[model samples]
Target: MIGIDLGKIFKGNLKEAVNVVNRVKEEHRSYLYSGIGRASILLFKDDFEKSVAFIEKIPPSYRDFCYQGIFYETVMHFHKYSPINNGWDSEWDIAKVIELLEKVDEKYKSSSCFGIGRGIMSFEFYYAESRRYLFSDLVWKSGKALEGIEASLNGYCFQGIGVEYGRKLLNYFFAQDYFQPEQGYSLDNRFFSEPLNKEINRTLKGDKTLKGDDRENYYEGIKMAVLENFKDEKVRNYILNRIRERERSSGN
Candidate 1:
């Protein structure tokens, strides 16, 4: 839908985009066929006041998803919107996102953070698998996103990341049972952290090992860059120790 919306907006079809949203709305109140269109206008063209005004006009039940779409698109398309050319400047992108998210109502914040985390880890896996970035670079890039986020909301982000990785590695049913949130299942650090540990273990198997300062920096980067704002000592230590254990077991 992003592609369709992008084309419509690029061609100055703002009314067309609105008509599509309205058309979908008429079919079902809960059916939002395309959010990326609204998100693009929010992030690229509209100011915060306009963004807020636009969202205010939405049904209260649907506003949270609006915030989620805006933040998700911001993170999902970081490379395209990033200030740097041919390189990631995640800090710049993160700051831009947080500036808007911070002002959002507290009730809607967690969903947006979840989108941010999901967005970062999706690209992390993409860049790592495609060899578009070194593992170290990927760590730093994701760290920038994690670092700028609120400490309390980081788990929501991690849950999103875990859901992404779980979807790739596990069957559809298991992914929901384990990672996807539901009435009985709340977002927990373990739900997300464990999957991340598994992903790192698999990724490291075929990747070059970081040695000396590079190695230390890699772990430290995970510690400081990723966990500086995250206050869960148990989860924080668990991730660091797990990586060290994997490094030792593999004879890195």
Candidate 2:
């Protein structure tokens, strides 16, 4: 079996390795398209060098997934895009897969990388949103992907992301197709609301100009303004729950 140690071997020549992986993807398209072959089996069966080669081709935006230390997850990322387009848990290999997942959790739990999410879901920046698509094509394409691991990503990966990109994501609400007459799309309000609220809170907290309740009142007013898009107070309250959900999602 290829095992996980191959990450070190392939690191020396990533570009050449990527070319080789492209060969596997192109040469073995049929293997990927078949029902039984869709599992990680096809990738696992490949030569170690070839598997690593395929992995090297993953986008630079997903650089956080490189084989530096988080090797298995790096492998899983490419596996998603490889001929084997799905995960496998056959009795023979299920234990190995479980071991890999535990490793993934451990690695992410202690690490801190602000760009990790934009790296993992950067594609979402341009094309997909996890809430809309259960898993964006880009997410599955990464193979080793997961959503909001350990809640640590809130500050490091997501909450700290660029406001411009965040604004683009928020722009979806203004779209004719997304904004409904019945406030049906209120669920999406937090995509922008949370960030805006966070910014408001940050500014208010830091402002020497506004003291005590003055700052608190200013922050509250900004939150109410965000609710302006929702004519119905009930819907606005529901859509604006993200601020509260942060702690819940974080399990704090």
- Evaluate all candidate structures by whole-model CA lDDT and list the values in order: 0.52, 0.34
Candidate 1: what lDDT?
Answer: 0.52
Residue pairs with clashing backbones, model 2: 21-54, 76-143, 76-144, 77-142, 77-143, 77-144
Candidate 2 C-alpha lDDT tens digits along 1-252? 121223333445445434544466453322221211112224445343453344435444333334222332332243232123132210111233233334433443322222232333344333335334322133223213333244433333322122213333334434523444454444357644454454333322222333333233323433433443345665466535643353234333
Please list the Cα RMSD from the true structure of every candidate, rounded to 1 decimal place.
Answer: 11.8, 16.1
**lDDT, residue 51, candidate 1:** 52
Backbone clashes in candidate 1 total 0
Error of 1 at 175 (Å): 18
Task: Tell me the lDDT of candidate 2.
Answer: 0.34
Worst lDDT run of 10 residues, candidate 2, spans: 30-39
Question: What local lDDT does model 2 show for residue 111?
Answer: 24
Using lDDT as the measure, which candidate wins? 1
